[model samples]
Target: MADKEATVYVVDLGASMGDCHNGRDESDLDFGMRYVWDKISTTVAASRKTWTLGFVGLNTDETNNTQDEEGLEGYHNISTLQEIGPMTMTELRELHPKVKPCEAYSGDALSAIVVAITMIEEFTKKLKFKRRIILVTNGESPIDDEDDSITDVAEKLNEHNIELVIIGVDFDDPEYGFKEEDKSRAKRQNEETLRKLVEACENGVFGTMQQAVEELSIPRIKPVRPFKAYDGPLTLGDPNKYESAISINVERYFKTKRATPPSATTVVVNPDRGYTQSQAFDDGDVEMGGTEFSNVKHMRKYKVNDPSAPGGKLDVPYEELAKGYLYGRTVVPFSDSDMAITKYETTKSFTIIGFIPFDSYSPFLNMGETGLIAAKKFDEKSEIGLSALIHALHELESYAVARYVQKDGAQVQILLLKPNPGIEDEYECLYDVPLPFAEDVRSYQFPPLDKVLTVSGNVLKEHRLLPNQDLKEAMSDFVDAMDLSGFDVDEDGNPVDYAPIDEVYNPVIHRLNQAIRTRAVHPDGEIGPPPEILLRFSKPPEKLIKKARPDIEALIDAAELKKVPEKAKGRFKEAVKPLSGLDIDAILGQKKRTVISPENAIPEFKQALATAEDDETVEKAVKQMGEIIRKLITNSFADVFYPRAAENLRVLREELIGLDLPLLYNKFLRALKKSLLSGELNGDRREMWFKYIIGGQLGLVTKEESEMSDVTEEDAKAFVKK
Candidate 1:
C-alpha cells in the first residue's frame, strides 16, 4: 500500500498578480500557476485515492472558507475552490476557471495559509498522512501579519507535521539568483512576512517561483509498491512422496520491468453532451473548451458474399463463426468439442528441474521481466530453509532451473534462479528471470570475420574484409580510451561508476509522462524539449572522446577509412555502369530515371516501358514500378497509399497483358504476396491483398484472360487463396 498524502495549493489571484512581472510575457498569475498545475496534475495522474489535493484562491471575488463563515476579519475575498479529497481530471477541470484573478485584491496571503492548514488538520484528524501546504504568489498583496499571528499558523503547521512551501514571483532569492529590480515597498513587506512564517516552521521551503518552475523539468521517478506475483511452496521434488524432498514457501515479486507510456483512449466528438467553458492560454494557444467528447463505439458485423442478398453480402450471426488454427497455409476449424484435444493443460506448480553452474548460464538467454523469489516473511522455518538453500547454491556458484505454472491450465515457463544471500537473521532470496525454450531461441550462422573464403573455397587471411594487426590494435586502444566504467566521481571525491543501471532512467517513459502531465493542464501548450537529465547519456563524455582522439586518428589511418556517401536506394540505383565509369543508358541514347516520385510514378513507369528498347530496359521499368509500390505501402500513414499502389498494379497488369508478358506480372504478384504477409512492408497488409488485389481481379493472369499466359485458371485462383 502507498502512503497517504494531503496537499493544499494556495494560489494568490490578486488584481496586482494579473499583470505581467519580471519582464515575462505572461501574467504573474499564469506564471505561478504553471508550478501549481504541474504538481496538481501529477497527483491527478497518479489517481491514488490516498493522494488528495485542495485548492484555495486568494483575492478571489467571493469568500467561502471556514474562517469567513465564522466572521473572520482577514479572510475576505478568499475562497476554497476545492476541498481536500481525491483529485481527478474532472476535479482539475472544475478548479481551472475558479482560480482566475479577480479585480478585488483585499485578501491576505497569511489568511489563505491558515485556511489551508485548518482544512488539512480537520480532514486528516487521527489519520497518518503526509500533509503539505504550497503557497504561490507574486508577493504583491499586503499581509496583515500583526493581527493574523504568523507564529500561531507556523506552530499549527509543525504540530500537524505539515510541510509549507512559499514561492514568490520575482522575489529576491540569492540561491536562485533572481530579484525584481525596483521592487515595491508593499511587496517587500509581504515577502519578508512570508519568509518569516516559513522560517518559524520545522519543515518549510521558501524560494522564488522561477526556481520552483525550473525544478519542474526534472522528472521525478515514481516508486511503485511491489505486488506478489506468486505465493506458494517452491519444491525440489514432491514432498508427499519422499520425506527427503525439500519444500520452501516463497513469494515472487517483480524486481525490474519495462515501463510503458499510457495508451490513449479512442474518443469522438458528440455535440449533444454538456461541456465546460474553459480556456487556459499559453504561448497564444487557447484550449478552446466546451468541445464535448465521448468514447468511440465499435460495431462489428460478419458477412459472406452472396449474390442473392440485396447488398451482395449476407450478414452472418457472430455466434455462428468458429475459431480456427492455422495449419500450413490453411485455417483448420476449431470447434468447442475439439478444443480440449489440443490444449496442454497444466496445474499451478513451481518446482526445480535441475541445477547448473552459474558460469554455464548466459545472460543472453534471459527473456523477460526479472523477479525476486523471497521466502515468506514471519515464517522462521521457511526463512531458515530458504537461507540454507541460498547459501549452499552461492557456495557452489550454481543456479537452479525451475518450471513454473502460475495457475491451472496456464502455460508453463522456464525460470533461471540465482541465489541472493542477506545479512544474518534477514530473509534470503533468489533472483529469477524467464529463460527461453529451445524452440524460442533462434540461431543464425554468419560468415567468419577472421578470414574470407574465395569462390574456389580457399581461405584468405590478408583480405580487406578482415582487420589487420595495426587496425585491430588501434581499434582496441580507441575502445579502451572511451570506456565509462569509472568516468564519474562521487560527492565524496571517490571514483564511482558512470551511468549506473539504477541511475539511468528510461527516457521514453519519463518523457511521455512529463508531456502527458504538462498537456493535461495546458492542453494546447507546447511541451518544452527533453529534460537535460534525460539527455545526459545521449552522447559519450566529451573529455573521453578528446582523450581517444589520437587512437581514433590512428585507426582511421591504419584502416584507410573514408566517409562513404549514402548510395541511391531502391531498384532504380541498379543502373548499369561500365568499367570506364560511363552511364550505360547515356551511351545507349536512352533517358534513364534515377528515381520515381509518388505523384507521377505510374505515368513515368508507363513512359519508361513504352520507350523500353530491349528486355533489360523493360526489366528496369518493372523494377522501378515495384519499388514505387513497396514505398507506397511502407510510407503510408494508414491505408491512404494502398489505393494508389493498387492503381499502379492495375495499370501494370494491363501493360503486361498488352505486351503478352504474363511472367512479369505473375512474378511480381508472387513476391508482393510474400512481402505483404511476411510483414516486410510494415504490417499485416492481408486486407490490401484481399480488397485491392484478389477482389479487384489483380491476381495471377490465367490463359482465359491472356492466351500468351501459361497459368491454369485453377492454379491462378488457388495462388490468391490467402
Candidate 2:
C-alpha cells in the first residue's frame, strides 16, 4: 500500500479587464471588473481540499525570461500584444498580486487557450494522475479576426478533458453610451458568443461572477488505514514442518481480471442439504457460484468397487486418486504422515466396495474396519478414496480464504500450479497472507495432521483457495480518497448568507444610479427629458426651471401641489413686464359700472380669461363678490403653479418601476407622506422624495450621503438656504 493519496492541480487564471478600451479605466468599468475578480478569486481559493494551486495570468502574457536548459521546450506567447509570464506559487506571492488593469486584446483568444492548456499539461505531467483544468473568463474571446477561430482550439482541449468555464462578467453592460436600440442587441450577441464558447469546450459554463465563484469551491479530505490477515491449519508432515504451502495457478483456473459475465458458472452449497449445487443439474443438489462459494468436497464421490472381477481383490493407485480430484495441486512433506504413507499400501482396493465421503462414514467404521468386512456394511476408505479425501480438504480451505478476500473487495487470484523442486513429493500449501503478518509465524497457527506431505513438484497435486480480507479494504480506501467532490468547481464559489446584500445588489443599482445621475447632470447628453417633456423643450430642464413666478400665492400653490409653474409665466412677463407694472387687469379684465366692479367677483380669473366673449354670468356680483373672487383667484393660481405636471408624473413612474416597487400609486402615496413630514424641501428635494421614498432605496446613495455629511454643517445650511 502507498503512504499518501493522489494530488489535484488548480490553476487560477486571475481576473483581468481585457485591453479593449485603451487600458483607460472608466469608473463604472473598473468597478465592475474589480467586483467580478474579487468574487471569483475568493470563491476558488475557498473550495478545494485535496488540490494545490498553481496560478497564472491569462491576458498579461509577458516574454520568456530564461532559456530552456533541460532540453524541455517551452511555449511562445501566441500573440505579440499580450505581455504574459508564468509565475510559480512563490513568485506570485512575492509580487503585490492584484488583477492588473489590463485591456482586452481582441486578438489573444487563441493564445489564452494555448497557454492555459499547455501550462496545465506541463504542470500535471510530474504528478502523473488525472488532471482537470478550470478556466474562468468573461466568455469574451479577444480574438476578433475573421480568419482564425477559437472553436478548433476548444476541440483540441476536449482531447485532454480539461473543463473550461467562461463566467460572463458585467453581463448587464452598465455603461451609458449605447443607444436604446443597441441595448438588447449587444446583450444578446455577447450572451450568444459566451454560449458558443462554453458549448465548444468540454464542460458547461456558469453565467455570472456570483455563480462562477460558487461553482469553483471545495472541502477537506480525511485519511484511512488498512487491515490485518488470518492464517489456517497446517499439515504436520508438510516439508516446512508445521507449514502448508498451496500454489494457485491463477492462469489455469482463475482469470486475471474478473470474468466478463462475472461468475458465468454458478457453484452454491447449502450445508443443511449436504451437497454442492452443480450447473449441469439445475436442482439444489448441485450448486455452482463463484469458485469461492463452491463446495466441491461434498460433491465428489470415489467408487472403489471392481465390478468385472467377482470375489477378487482390486488394486487402486493413490496418484490416480489425487489426480482425479485436484487438477493442479502442489504439496510438501510433513511429519508422521510420511511414515504412515510408506507403511500403508495406498494402492489397495476391495471387491464390491462402495464409495462415500469420510465425513459421512457409516456406523460400521466406528466399530473398526472389521465391522465393514464381516457385517457386510458400506465400503468407504479404499486406497484411492484417501487421496480424493485429502484433495477435498484442500479445496474447502482454499475456497474459504478466497471468499474472505473477495468479500472484503480486493483483487485475488486462485492459481492451480505445479510445486517447486524440493525434498519430497506430498501435499502442502503456500497461500499469500497479509503483508506484514506473513512472516509472523506465532500469530498464525494451524492444527497438525498425522498425514505426511511433500514439497516436490511431482508429489504436489493442486492447491485450492481461501479468503483474504486485507486487500479489499485497501482498494475501497483508494476510491474514497479519490472522491470527485474535490474536482467540483462550484464548491468554493457559493456566497455566504452573511455577505451584505447591498454588495450583491448595489452594483446593479449603482449602474442604474449612474445612468440616472448622468442624465440629471447633462440632460441633453443621453437620457433626454421624459418623452412628454423632451417633445416640449429643445433646451434642458436645468435651463427651463430657473425662472420663477412673482405671485406669492401662485408660488405657494406650486409648492403644495408638488409641481413646476408654467414657463409661459416667465415668457409673458419678459415680453410685457416693462409696460403697466406687468398688470394683467388693465390688459384683459372686463369693465363694470356697479359700486363693486364685476371683476371683483373673480379677480384672477377675470384677468386670466378676460378675452372670453361668451355670455357667462358673473353671479358673484349678486352675492359677496369679494370672497367669491378670492376663491376663483386661488383656483386659478393653482393652475399657474403646476406646469410640468405630466412630465413629473412620467419621471416619477419610471423611478418607481426602476425600484421594482408594487405600483406607481403606492410610490406616489409614499412620496406624499414623506414630503408632508419634512417641511424643508426644494424641487430637487421633492424629486428625491419621489426618488427614494417612492423608489425604495434608490441604490448606492449611501456613498453620496456620506460625502454629503462630510461638508460642514454651516456650509450645508448655507447651501440649503441658497
Candidate 3:
C-alpha cells in the first residue's frame, strides 16, 4: 500500500449559508457539505489505503458564542469536529447532521485556516503524510483585524508544505435571488482576499462549487513501469550442426551511447634549441643552426559529467560504442577488443530437457493446463526462443529430429531436418551406385505404322460430293436478283444503300390492281371502276369517286359541319363567375399591403382573430400568430415579441374569462403543455420558452415550481384530469 494522505475539509457555516441556491431546497451549507462528503466517501472507498480525511466547520453555534479559547485565542467561530484519521462509512454518515448553518454571524476565513493548520500539524506529527485543506465558502468572510491577515495563514500552510483549495459558491448566482443592490461591496473585497491567499500557497486551487466536486470524483491511478519481452531464439549448442542442445528463454535490455568529441583543435610547436659552445677543451665543432621546428596536432577527449560521482567527469572514446543487450536487470559492458563480434548478456530463465511431438503445433501455443506447452515462471527468454524455432520450422515446411543428451551434465537439443531435393521418395539411400545419363538409358519397343492405318467408304463418298453445283447456281441467282446499282459509298468510304423504290411499288401496285378487279365485281353489283385505278392514271375521276363514295366526301367536309355556335345572344347572356365565391375585394386589399416588420404581423394576427367566427378558427389564428412570434424571436427580435406575447396573453386571458368558456381555456392550456413537453425548443430556447410562455404568459406551474407552491397533490391530479 502507498503512503496515506490527510485531507482537512474546512466548511463555512456562516449566516449567508442559510440561503438556498442552485435550485435546491436545502441551504447552500447543507448542499455543499453533502456534496463534499459524498465525494470524500467515494475517494476513500476507491483508495482505502491512500486517503485519510478530517472535518472542520467554521462559524458554528459553540464557536460563535465563545470569543476565545486556549491555543485558539485569535481564531474565533471555528470548530474542529475530527482530526485527520482513516475515514470510514460510519464516520462519513455522522457528518451530515454535524455540518449545518445554525450560527448567527459569518465565518472568519483566517480563523478557519488557522484551525485547519493546527489540526493537520498535530495529525501529521508521528507519520509524515501529504496534507491538504479544502475550504468551502461563499467568499463572504468576516473582515480580518489589522494585525492578522489571511496571507499569514497561507504562509504558514506553505511553510508546512500543505495544499489549500478554496471552493467558492458565488452568492451573486442568479439562482440565489440576490438583486444588484443586494450585492455588498465587502463581498468583492472578500473574494479578492481569498484569491490572494490562494496565490500565496505553492499548491493552491480556487474553483467554483461544481468544479471542486467534479475534480474529486475522478480516480487517480498509479502508473506502471514499462518493460519489453525478447522475441528471438537462444540455444546452448551449435545452431547449424545436428547436436543435442537445450532451448532457453531470455529477456533483453538496450543500452545506447553517443560519441561526442572535443570542441577545439590544439597544435604543439617544437623549436630546435641552438647548441651551446664547450669550454677550452671543445673536442668537436658546435652546431648553431640545427633542425627546423615541427608542428604536431593533438585532440582532447570529450568528457561527460558523471552523476554518480560528485564534481567528476569521465572521458569518452572517439569510436561509436556498440549496443548492449541484457537478459535480466544485470548490465554487461561491451568488450572494446572484440568489438567486431556481437554478443548478448543472457541469464538462463528456463531449460527444455524434453520434446513432445503432436499432429499440430497450435495446442502448444495456447495458455492453459490443457495446452501442450509448459514453462518456468522466470522462463520469458526460453518461451521466446522456442516460439522462434517453431516459427522457423513452420516457415520452411520441415520437421525436427529430437535428441536427448545422454551425458551427465549435457542439455537437450533438437536439430531441424530438411528433405534432400535430389533424392526421390521411393529410392533408398545408396553410397556406391551412380545413376546413368538420360540419353544412355534403355528404351521401349514401338508398333509398325502401316498395320494401324485404315480408310472408310464414307470418306470416298464425301470427297466425290465436294463443291455441289446446285448451291453455286442458287448463290448466282440470289446475287443477280439483288439490285446493287442503287448502293453508293459516303465520303468516309462506307456503303450507304438506298432501298429500291421498284420493290416497294411492285408489291403495293399488284395488291391494288387485284383489289380493283375484285371490287369491280362487288356482291351488291359492279361499283363502276375502282377509284384507285382511275386515280393512278391521272384522270379526273373526282366526280365518279364522289358519286361512288359519299362517306369519303362527308369526311372531307367534316370541318365545316363541326363549327361552334355563336355566343348566346340577347338578355340571357352569362354573368362573370364570382371567382369561386371568394371575396376578391378582401384578398386584393391584403395583397396590396406589405408586411414590413414583426410589429406589422401583430396587427394582422389580431385582425385574423377578430374576424374568426368560431373557436376553431380562433385557435388556428393563435397558432399562426405563435409561429410568427417564434420567427421574430429567432431573428433577434425577442425583446420586441417577448413583451408583446405577454400583453397578448394577458388580453386573451381576460377575454377568455369574460366569455366563461372553460372548454376553450382548457384546450389552450393543453396546447401550451404539449408545446413545453415536445422537444422542439433546445438549450436557451427552452429556458426562454419556460420563463415566458409557461410561467409568464400561460401561468402554468412546472414540476419544480409546483413542488414549492401551495398547490396540493389532489389539485395537480385534478388539473391533469381536466
Candidate 4:
C-alpha cells in the first residue's frame, strides 16, 4: 500500500488547439485532452494509493469584464472546471463541453497555473499526499510582461514542492497546416518562456504530448531491494536419541496493513462569508446593550418531493415525529473520532527439527508417504501445526531437510523439516541426507567466504580454447581490408598500441570455442563446423554446392528451365554431373529442402530499392543477395544477372539508379548493371559481391548527389496521383 496523491491537469484551450494535427480528425487540443484524461483515469485505477484528480482550462473565456486605471484590465481567463477531489468517469464525461477553446483571445496560462496551485493547496491542506500538476499545451501563448507573472507562479509552485510535468505538443505538425515559414516571433518567445517556467520547477519533466502520455500510461511500480540470503546458522534437535546440528538459512515474511477510509465531520458555517463556525449565530444573538437576553433556537430547512407541486418539490423544516428511539437517534448522530493504525506483523515461525536416516525416510520424501513409525504426540494439536508447516514448506517449493523427532516419551519418532524457496507443494522430493561411510560421519568442503574466484590458467592454456582466435583474426583482416579506423582509440582520440591477444580476451574466446565445439561437427563426409563459423575464418567456396549429389541435381533441375539458356544447357549439366550419384536425404538428415526462388528474391529487391536509404532495408537486402548468390553460383551460373533475364535485370538496375544511392552502393549497382547489359560474367558473382555481402555497409548519399538527382516533390506527387 502507498500514500494518497493529488494531480491537477491544466489543459490549454487556445484557438490553435482547434486546428487538426497530422491529418487526424481530432484537433491537437482534442488529442491532448483525451490523452490527459485517459492517463489520469488509468493512474487513478491502477495506483495502490488513493488518487484525487482535478481539471483546469487555460485560455478560456470564463472571466469577468472589469476595468482598472487602464481602459480594460487583462482578463484572468483561467477556468477551474473541476476542483481538486476524488474524480469519477461521469464527472469527467460532463466536462467535455466545458473544455472548448475561448472565442475571443488566448487564455492566460500564467493565471491558470496560479489558480490550479490555489485549488490544489486548498484541497490537500489536511491530507498527507504527493501533489503534481500536469500542463498540456502547445507552447503557443502570448507572454504577459506584468511584473514577470510566469516566474512568480513557477516560484510559488516550487515553494510548495509541487512537481510539474509539461506535455508540449508541436504546433507545426503538418495536420495543423502551420508551416515553418509561418512561425511568428511571438510564438518563439512563448516557447522560451515555457522552457524557463519548466526549468524553474525542482522536479520537472518536459516532453512531447505523445511521449508524456505513454510514460504516464505505463505502470510504474516502486522497486524493492533484492532479497539477500540469511547467513546465520540454526540448530536442530532430536530431544530423545541425540541432537544433530547444521548451519542453515531462512527468510522472513510479514503481513501488510489494510487501508482505512477518511472520517467525516459535520460543521456549522456562516451564510455570508461561507466560512465554517462553531455555531450559526446572528446579530440578534449578541445583545450586549440589552438588560436581558433571550435564548432562542433556530430550525434548519430541507427539501421534500411533492407530486402535487409544479416541480414535484417542497421545502420544510424539522417538525414533530413519532416518539421512538429511531427518531431520537436520527436527531443526535454519533461518529467515531479515533482511528486504528495498521502495521505489518509476523504470525508464524518455522525451523528444521532434525535429520532422519536416508533409507527409512526416502519413501516419504520421494512419494509423500513414509514407512517410519509415527510418534505418540502426533495427535490433533500436532496435526494442525504440521498442516501449517507443510503449507509454508509447499509455498517455498524448494529443498528441505527431513529429521526424526521424539515427543511425549514415545518410542516411535516423527519427522519434521524445512524447505527451500520457490518449491512447489505438489512436487515429489527425491533427496536425502546420506551417510557416506561406515563410521557414520562425513565432511564436505565449501568455498572460503573471502576467496575471489577466477578462471583457471590450465583451461586458458588449452589450444582448443583458441577457436575464436581465428574468428578474431578474420575480423581484424576484414577491418584492415576495408581500411576501417577508430576501433581502438584512447579518450584523447589517439590510437593505442597493445597486444591483440590478452587475458581479458581468453574468457570470451573460450566461451565461443565451447559454443562451437558443442554445436559444430568436423568435415570429411561428417558434420562440419557451421557454415557461418567456417565462412568467417576462411575464404568462400568457388561453387556453393551441397556435398550430396542429389542436392546438386535438385538445384540444377529447379533452376534449369528458368535460369539457364539453351546454349548453356550442356555446360550447366556438365557442372552438376559429378553430384549425380550421392544420397541427398542422408546428408540432409531430418532437415527440410530449401529452394531459393526468384519469386521471393524479386519482392525483396523491390522493397530494397524503395527503402535503400534505411539501414534496416539495406541489411535485409544484403542477406537476401547472399542467399541468391550462393544458389546461383552452385547452379553453374557465373553471375545472377544472365542473358535470358537481361531485360528484367536492366529494369531493376535502372530503378536502383533512380533511388540516387551513395557512390559506394552505386558502384555495386553499376556492376550488376554492366553484367546485365553485357549478358555474361567473367567469374563467379560471389568473388566481387563483398560490398553487398554485409548489411548496413553503405553510407548516406552526399549532398551533391542528392541535389543532382532528378526526382522532385512534384514527381513524387505525380507518382502518387497515378
Candidate 5:
C-alpha cells in the first residue's frame, strides 16, 4: 500500500545453505520459512495495490567456485525494489531463486556486514523524510563461543548509524542430519546481536525475512523508502498503485518571507536625559560613558517613577523588563564622539545608541562568576590572554580601592564618589589633628613621648635660670614642667598644676592593627579578612612585593623565570641618538607663544615706523606688525591674569600645538582669515607692513616663508613660473 514502508535485505549464507536444513525436516524448514514469510507478506502487502518488493540471496562461498554459464545457471534470481505512491502498487517478483550453501570456511562477517551497511547508510544518510534499512545474513555464523568475535563486528555495524535488519537462516536442524546446535545457536545469536547495530541507527530492525518484510510493509504516517530490492512473485496483489509522491514548492513558500527592521516608533528613553532641567543643572548634568551608560538604563527601568499612582510613567515597576532578559545584559556605553554611524549598520543594522534596552546589567560586571566558571571548566586561566588579564586586573583594582565606612555600628556609606557623572571619583579619609593636641603624634606617649620628653629636657636645661622671666618664659616653663605629669615649678620653687590626668585611649591605631592581624590567616586553613587590610598598613615597598608574590610564584612554577629581564638603562639611552638638524629647544618650544619684540614695545613700534616709507613697504611693515600682534595676543592669552590661569593656558597651548594646526587651518579656518584680512591697506597697520618688508630684506624669514618651503619642488616651480 502507499502507506507502507519498504524493508529489504540481501542474505549471504556462505556455502552451507545447500547442505543443511536447519537440522530439521525439509517440510519443517519450509514451514518455518513460509510461516515468517506469509506473516510479513500479509501485513506488508495489506492493500496489495502499491506494495514494493526487493530480494537477493547469495551463498558466497558456495558460488566462489561455480561459474555462471548462462543467465540463471548458478546465480540466484533477484528482484528490484520500486518506489510506490500513497495509493498504488506495482507487479514485481523474485522467481526460481537458488541457494547453494557451502561447507565450513573462513568466517568474515566483518567484511560482509561492512559492505551491506555502507550501501544502506549511504542511501539513507540524506533522506530525512524517509527511513531505510538492509538485512544481510548467513544463518551459520562463524563466531567463536569464547572470543565474542561476532559481537565485535556487530558493534562496528552499529556505528554506521543507519537503520539495519538481520536475517539468519541456519540449516543445522536434527532432521537435516546437521547435529551441531552451534550453527543454529550462532545464527540465532547473530540475528539477535544486531540490536545494538539497529539501536545505533535511527531506523533498524532484526528478524526473519518474512517477518522483516511484513514489518516494512506496514503503513507509517511518514513512510520510509526501502533499503534494497523486494523479493516476491509477480501478482495482482502488488501495492505500488497506492503510492504517491509528496513534494513541496520551496521557492514559492520562501518568497513570501519579509526582512524586518526595528520599529521606528520605539522611543528608548535615555536615563540620563530623563532628569529634569533643574536636577541636571544642579547635579552638573550626569554625563555617562562606557558600561555606566547601560547600567543607568537598567537602574532606571527597575525604578518606579510613581509606584503609588493609578497610571503614571512607572506605575508598573521597571524590574519586569529584567525578568526575561537577564542573560541579554550585554550593553555597554560609548562616548557620543566615539560613536560612528557605520557601527550601527551591521548584520542586524542596530541603533548603537538608541533602543538601549531599558533594563540590563553589564556582563563585564559579572566577570567574577564568569571568570571562575570559565577558569574551572575550560582551563581559561591558562588560556586567557594578556588583554583579558588586563581587563580583569582593572576591574579588581577598582573594587580593591573602594572603601566602605560603617558609622555608629549601624549606618553604612560608600566613601568613594564619582569624580563627575562622566568621570570616576573616589573618596578617602583624611587625618585632622586638633590644634591643641596635634603635637602628640602617638598614643599615650611611649616612643613619641620619649622623644618629646628628651626635647623638653634640652629646652629646660637651655633656659635653666629663667624662673622670673616674662609670659614667654613662663610658657616655656610650663612646657618644661612636663615630666610624665602635669606639673610646673612656680617662681617660689614649688610645684603647680593646671590640668587633671586621665587614662588615654588609642582606638584608631588598635583597630588598624587588629584589621591587619585578621588578614594574615591562610584561606586553606581558615577564611580570613581580605589581604587589602594588611596591604594598607604595610607601606609602599612591602605592599608591592606582596602584590606581585602570586605572579612570581606562578612564573617559577611554569619555569618562565627567564621572561623577566634585568633592565640596561645606560644601554637603552646609548641606543638612542639625537636626529640631525633637529633643535631640541625649538621643537619643544613650538607650542610656546614667544613675544616677537621682547624690549619696550613702543620703542619697537617706533623703529618699525622709521623703516616704512612707501605703500609696499608699509604693507610689509603692517604684515610684520600683524604677525607680532597675533603672537602677542597668543602670549597674553597664554599668560592670563592669574598665575594658575596662565599655567592652565600653557597646558592648553601645548595640547593645541599637539594637533596639526596647518591641516586644521587649511580645512576649517583659512577662509575665515582671508575674509578678515581683505580690503585696502591705508591705516597704521599699513605702516607696520612696511617694517616687515624691511625686516624681510634684512633676512628675517617669516612663518609664511617656512610654509612655502614645505611645498614640493614641482609645485613650487609651477607656482613661481605661473
Candidate 6:
C-alpha cells in the first residue's frame, strides 16, 4: 500500500438531486455530499502534500473539466471544484460551498468518471501514487455509454491500478437490507451501468449510499513508522573501570504516546474578498468573502509603566531587554552574553546508576511516557550482551535506575528500566519509564480513616468520624453493582468487558475532529450529537444504577451524607444573611450599608469600606461591589453596562492594591476572566477583557505595584492574552 495517494471525488449535483427523496428530509445531493466531505476532510487533516485530492461536481451548471478542455464530445455539466493537488484548509473551504445541487437536470455519469480518471492520470503521471476515484450520486442523471467509452474507462482504471468506488443514493442493496420502493427508472438503469463498470474494473467497490454514509463515523487511524528516539548504548555500571560491568549498544523507540487533537488558531478574515458586501452578512461564514484568510502573527515588545508617557507605558526594544529570573521578589538580570553561565550543559549519555528490587520501585512513581530499550538491530554482540543482562535482571527480580540524556542539549531524565525475557523467536528487551527527580516528588501524611485521634492523642475506632460496618458493606455493594466489567455480552451470550482498551477512544480528540469536519461540510446544519459509543461509559449504566438503588440509599443513610447547600455558585453573588444576628457595623458604632446600589455603586462601595477596621468588613464591601458589576453586565443590553462594570472593577482593583491585598483582587479578576471567556455572562464577552482589563491597565498586580504580590511582571503582562 502506497502512503502517497491521488484521489478524485466525483459528487452528483443535478437538478433532481435538489428535491428530497424516499421520505428523507434532506435532498439526495446533501445526503451524498456527507460522505464526500468526510473523505475530503480526512485528506486535509493528513496534511501531506503527496496525498493529493481533487473534487469534481457531476451534472453541475458549468463545464470546466480537463476532458472538456481537450475538445471532448461528452463530459458536459462537469465542473472541477478543486484541483488535483494537496488538500489544504483553504481548498476545503473553497470546495465546501461549491458541492451543491445544480440547475442542470441531466449529465453523463460515465463522462464524469472519465473526467476523474483523466484528473488522476494527469496529476499522478505514472508515478507510484495510490490513485482512487469515488463517485457518489442519486443515479438519476443519464450517463452516455453509447460507445466503447465505458470499456475504455474501465480498462484505463485497471491499467493504472486505480480504485473506483461507486455509491448510489436510494439504490437497492440486499446485503445492506436497503431497497427503495419507488426508485426512478432512469436511476435504476444508471445504477446498473455503474455496477457493470465496477465489475469491469480490477479494483472497485459498489455499495448503497446509506452503507457508505453509515461507516463515516468510524475513525481512520493514520499509519506511522516507528522513529528511533535514541540510538546509543544501554550501559550498566562503570564499564571503563570494571571489566565485569555491562555495556551494550541499544536503541530507544516510543511504545505508546497520548494523541492530541488538532489545535485551533486565530486568523484574520478579509470580508472584502467575497464576504459582507450586502446588508445581511453571515458572521459565521468567514469564507463568505471567498474563503480568504490571513494568518495572525504575534509581535513581542517589553514595556515599562511610566506616568510621564502619553499612554502611561514606555516601549523598550527587544535588544535592550535582559532576561531576568525571579528571586525572592527581586529580578536577577542576566544579559545574553552571560546566559551560558546559568545553563547546565551536558553531553548525551545513558548509564545505569544503580539497581533496586522490583518491589521497592512503585509503579505510581512513573511520571512520563514508556518506551523500549532494545539492543541495536542486527548487532549480534550487542544483542547477546543485552540478552544476558536482561536474563540476570529477570532472575534477580530487579530494575535498573539509569540517567538517560537522549542527545546533546536534550532534557536529562531519570529512567527505570525493567527487564523482559523473551521466548525462542522473540528478542529480549527492557521497558523503560521516565522517573521523577527528588525535588519533583511530594509526600503527604493524613490521619487513618478507620480510626481518629482525640485531643489527648489517643486513637479511637468507634468514634463518630469512623465508618460503621453497615456503611462499609453498603458502599461495597454499591461499588460492585456499578462496575462496568461484564456489562456487555459476547456472541455466545457470555458476559464480556465493556469499553476494552483498544475500543475506548479519547472523546475530546475524536469529538473535536468530528465537529470540525461537520462544520466544514455543512456550515448551517446543526451538528449531530456525539456518537453514542463515545459517551457510553461516561456514567453508570441506568439499569445497574436502578438495581443498586437500595444499596445506594442504605449507604447514604448509614454515612449520614447530606447534600451541602451550594454557596451561590462561588463567584456569582447574592444577598448573605449573618446567622449570628449580630450586626458588626452596629457593634463598631457605625452601620455601614450592606449593599452597593447598582445606580450609585462606586460612591456607596467607598462608603461601605470607609469605616472598615478588619479584613472581614473590607471583604464584604468588595463582594458588594463585585455583585453590582456582575448584575450590570448581565442585565444591560450589549455593551451598555460594560463601561460601568469596568469602572467597578477598576475601583476594586485600586482599593485592593492600596490596601496591600493583591491576592483578593487577583482571585476576583481570574474568576471574572473565566466567566467572560466561557460566555457565562453572555456570548463570550472577551471584548470587555481586551478593552477594559488589558487595555485599561487593570490586570494582575505585579510586585512593583504591590509589595505583597507574588505575580511577576511577565505573568502580569501575559495574563490578559491567556
Off by over 4 Å in 5: 1-4, 19-23, 27-32, 39-53, 61-110, 122-125, 129-138, 143-161, 167-722
Q: In model 6, what is the error at residue 75, expressed in angstroms?
A: 3.9
Pick by lDDT: 1 or 2, better one: 1
Q: Which is better, 1 or 5, measured by TM-score?
A: 1
Please, what is the whole-model Cα lDDT of each candidate in the order they appear? 0.85, 0.35, 0.52, 0.48, 0.33, 0.82
lDDT of 3: 0.52
Best by lDDT: 1
> TM-score per candidate, in order?
0.76, 0.24, 0.33, 0.35, 0.21, 0.72
Q: After best superposition, candidate 6 residue 654: deviation in angstroms? A: 17
Model 5 whole-model lDDT (C-alpha atoms): 0.33
Tens-place lDDT per residue, model 3, 1-722, is 46568888888888888897656687777657645755574454444656887888887776631235564465666777776777654454456567777654655777777777877787687577888989888766575743357667778988888999887775332443433335567877776677778787899987667554444333222333323222223354545574676554433221112222213223233334343332111322222112122334457776779876556876777675544658598767676767645433333232232333435333223221110122223667665555565555445655443332323344332222222222354311101111223453567887432233225523232232342344445445444434344344678877665333322223234334334323322223343333342234344235434443544333435322344445433212332235366866577775322232455655665455444456666666556555554454444333554566555555554444433333344455556545545634321344445666556645533333323234455654565545
Q: Which stretches in model 2 have alpha-carbon errors above 4 Å?
A: 1-53, 61-89, 95-98, 123-128, 139-141, 145-148, 171-191, 204-206, 214-722
Better of 1 and 4 by TM-score: 1
Off by over 4 Å in 3: 22-25, 47-50, 64-68, 145-148, 171-182, 213-722
Give per-residue CA lDDT, model 5, range 636-717, as digits (tens): 4323322332232233222222221222222212222232235222212322222332222311222353442234545434
Question: lDDT per residue, candidate 2, 338-382, as tens digits?
Answer: 556655233111111122333442232121111001111132333
Clashes of 3: 6
lDDT head-to-head 2 vs 4, winner: 4
lDDT of 1 by residue, 1-722 (tens): 68999999999888988898667899999989888898898898888999998999999888899998998788898899999999867667768878787997888888898899899989999799999999998887788766358888888889999999998888899877887889999989888988999899999999998888888877787888897889999999899899999999989999987778788876566665455543332322222245555566679999899999988999999888888989999999988778888889899999999999977988988999999998898988898999899999999999999999988888899999988886654646899999998899889999998999899999999987789899889989988888887677889978888987766877888899988887888777798888888898899878888888898899899989766555443223333345567876677896755455668988788767655557787777788888889898888777888899999999989888866787888999999999988989998787788888888899999998788788998998778774
Clashes of each: 0, 87, 6, 10, 72, 3
Better of 1 and 3 by lDDT: 1
CA RMSD for every model? Answer: 11.0, 41.6, 46.7, 29.5, 42.3, 11.8
